[model samples]
Target: MDKKDRSILALLQTDAKLSISDIAERVNLSTTACWKRIQCLNEGGYLRQQVWLLNSKMLGLGVTVFMSIKTSHHDLQWLRKFALGVRDLPEVLEFYRMSGDTDYLLKIVAPDIAGFDRVYKKLIQIAELFDVSSSFAMEEIKYTTALPLDYTHTA
Candidate 1:
């Protein structure tokens, strides 16, 4: 992507509510050009779906646990079953594949200890996973949706 595209992305990253005209004016481009650029970005898969970030505490999901999981197998058959099981669990806010001793890392938000217990029991039934390391989020110091703009690449 070019600098102009990056600029547009940067603006949208901060506040997606900006109108096409507003964006065009700021970037010194015509409205049609700005709209076309946005459309191209969407078509090219640079623009993902927008989200409304919610407060877990206000939603009565005050407990946040980061669970590190180590699976017995990463084979396609076992992975498929694990994927399906996680989809049914409402408490799993985020699931990620990482590089470490853990195969999967989950960011789970539950209402209480009882909620966590129920989810944990269900996880065991779904896969042959034996290792789990869970940590609680005591306080959030830095949380951001914006990516850093300072990556210098050599091509």
Candidate 2:
């Protein structure tokens, strides 16, 4: 990737709805060149799917829960089953296998405590968990889908 490629990515990250001509103008490239660059980026796996972000509060999903999970099962089969189960849950926005005291972490959004409890019940049935701890987010200080492009390698 070169400087112009990086600029194209930065522009797209800011607003995915920007037209090819708009991107080209901002990056000082021809419309065709910008369009080709974007295609290349997509083919190269640098660009992922684009989707609109909705307002959770307005959609009646005001509660955000960070759930820390601990489990004794480390076998691949158990992990596969657990991962599949968790991934199928629509409430789970983010799930990660972490190092340290927490075995796994899940970021879940729901309408309220009752909604979360329903998810919690389904979660416990998926696997034999050693411990499960949940913390509710009081405020979101910063949230963004855009990633930093400063570390991109240019040629």
Candidate 3:
């Protein structure tokens, strides 16, 4: 990607609603060229699907819990089952297979402690886990969907 593509991506990352003409003006490109570049970015997988970020608090999910999970079973079948089971749970916003003491990590959002307890009950029912520990976040310092564009390869 060149400087123009980087600029375009930066703009889109902030707000995906910008018109082609608006982006073209900022990037110093013709409208058609700007449109083509966006298409290329999408097709080349540089631009992932755009989404509306919803506030958990406003949506009645105020509690944020980070769950560190350790399991005795590490076989393919067990992993697949665990993956499928967790993916079905709506409260789980993010899941990760980690590289340290914890085998897996899950980010769960709940309305309150009671709601979180329900989620925990559901999780233990799904599989046999060696350890399941959760830490509640008191406050969110900073969160963002935008990625830094400085790391992108440039011409």
Candidate 4:
């Protein structure tokens, strides 16, 4: 990507609601040119999707937790089943297949302890897991909905 493309992406990452004209003004480009660049970025798959950052607390999702999962059998078939089970679970906001002691890590949000309990119970019934440890996030000190934009210079 060009330097202008990088700058355009940086601006949008902070606020997707910015008008094309406003973005063009800030990035030293004409409105149409800026709009074309954004469209290219999207069509080229550089920009996947835009999302609204929501506050879990304000939505009554008062509890957030990280679940570290491990399985007795690390076979691929079992993993597929596990993934499918978690795929549509509304409480799980994010899932990561990690490189560590755990096979997967899940970021979950629930209304309260009881709400979380319901999710917890349902998940255990998916498979006979070796370990499923939870670590509640007491406070999210810094949560950024944006990715760091130093990728322009990457080889």
Candidate 5:
């Protein structure tokens, strides 16, 4: 990727609805060239699926919980089953296997504590867990879906 490609990505990250013509104009590239570059980026896996971010608060899902999970089962069979169970839960927006004290981390959003309790109940039913801890987010100081392009290889 070159400077222009990086610029294109930056603009798209800001607003995915921007037209090819608008992107072309901003990046100082012709429409056709801009389209080609975008296609290349998509083909090369630099561009993942495009999605519209929804307002959780407006949608009645204002509560955000960061759940830390620790389990004794480290085998693949247990992991596969646990992963599949977590994937089935729509309330879990993000899940990760981590190092250090925490075995797994889950970012969950719900309507309230009662709603979160429902998810927690289902989660514990998935498998035998050593520990499960949760922390509620009081305020979102900074949150963004956009990633920095400074680390991208320049041509």
Candidate 6:
């Protein structure tokens, strides 16, 4: 990753919809060169899948909740069942196996308190949890998908 490659990545991270010509101009590279570089970045797995971040309020999902789960079962089978149960739920936007007292954490989006309760009930029916706690966000102060590129190095 040279300076030109870094520049291209910075631009693309800001907006994946940018055209190859626009990226080329911003990075000061020829169109062909920029295209090939992007291809290399994709092949090398440095560039992952691009995604659009949606506005929660606009989509009728105004409530954001973080759920902390603690499970008594630590066996592989139990963990697999829990993972599958949560994975099938569309409301679960993010899931992580935590390292602290909580066994897992999930970020859920819903329309309101009733909607969140429905999701919670469905989740508990799938797998028995020792403890489940939810924290609702009053507002989304900041959010972003862009990754800092300063740590990347030219190979």
Q: What is the C-alpha lDDT of each candidate?
A: 0.84, 0.95, 0.95, 0.88, 0.97, 0.92
User: Residue 1 of candidate 1: its Cα lDDT?
Assistant: 62
Write out the backbone clash pairs for model 6.
Answer: none
**What is candidate 1's lDDT per residue for 1-155, written digit by digit as tens?**
66667777788877878999999888888999989988897899877877767787898998889999997797999988998999899899789888977889998888988888888888889889969888888887787788765562312
Ranking by lDDT: 5, 2, 3, 6, 4, 1
Cα miss at 78, model 5 (Å)?
Answer: 0.6
Tens digits of per-residue lDDT for model 3 on 1-155? 99999999999998878899999999999999999999999999998888778889999999999999999999999999889999999999999999999999999999999999999999998889999999999999998888999998899
Better of 3 and 5 by lDDT: 5
Candidate order by TM-score, decreasing, is 5, 2, 3, 6, 4, 1
What TM-score does each of the candidates earn? 0.87, 0.97, 0.96, 0.94, 0.99, 0.95
- Candidate 4 residue lDDT tens string, 2-82: 878888999999998999999999999999999999999899888878887887889999999899988777788988888
Evaluate residue 100 in candidate 2 and report its C-alpha lDDT on the 0 to 100 scale: 99
Score residue 86 of candidate 6 by CA lDDT.
93
Runs of candidate 6 exceeding 4 Å displacement: none
> In candidate 2, what residue range of length 10 has the lowest lDDT sum?
46-55
Kindly give the stretch of ten consecutive residues in candidate 5 with the minimal lDDT sum.
46-55
Roughly what TM-score does model 2 have, to 2 decimal places?
0.97
**Preferred candidate (TM-score higher): 3 or 6:** 3
Can you write out model 2's per-residue Cα lDDT over 93-127, one digit (the tens) per residue?
99999999999999999999999999999999998
Clashing residue pairs for model 4: none
lDDT of 5 by residue, 115-143 (tens): 99999999999988999999999999999
Model 6 / residue 155 / CA error / Å: 5.6
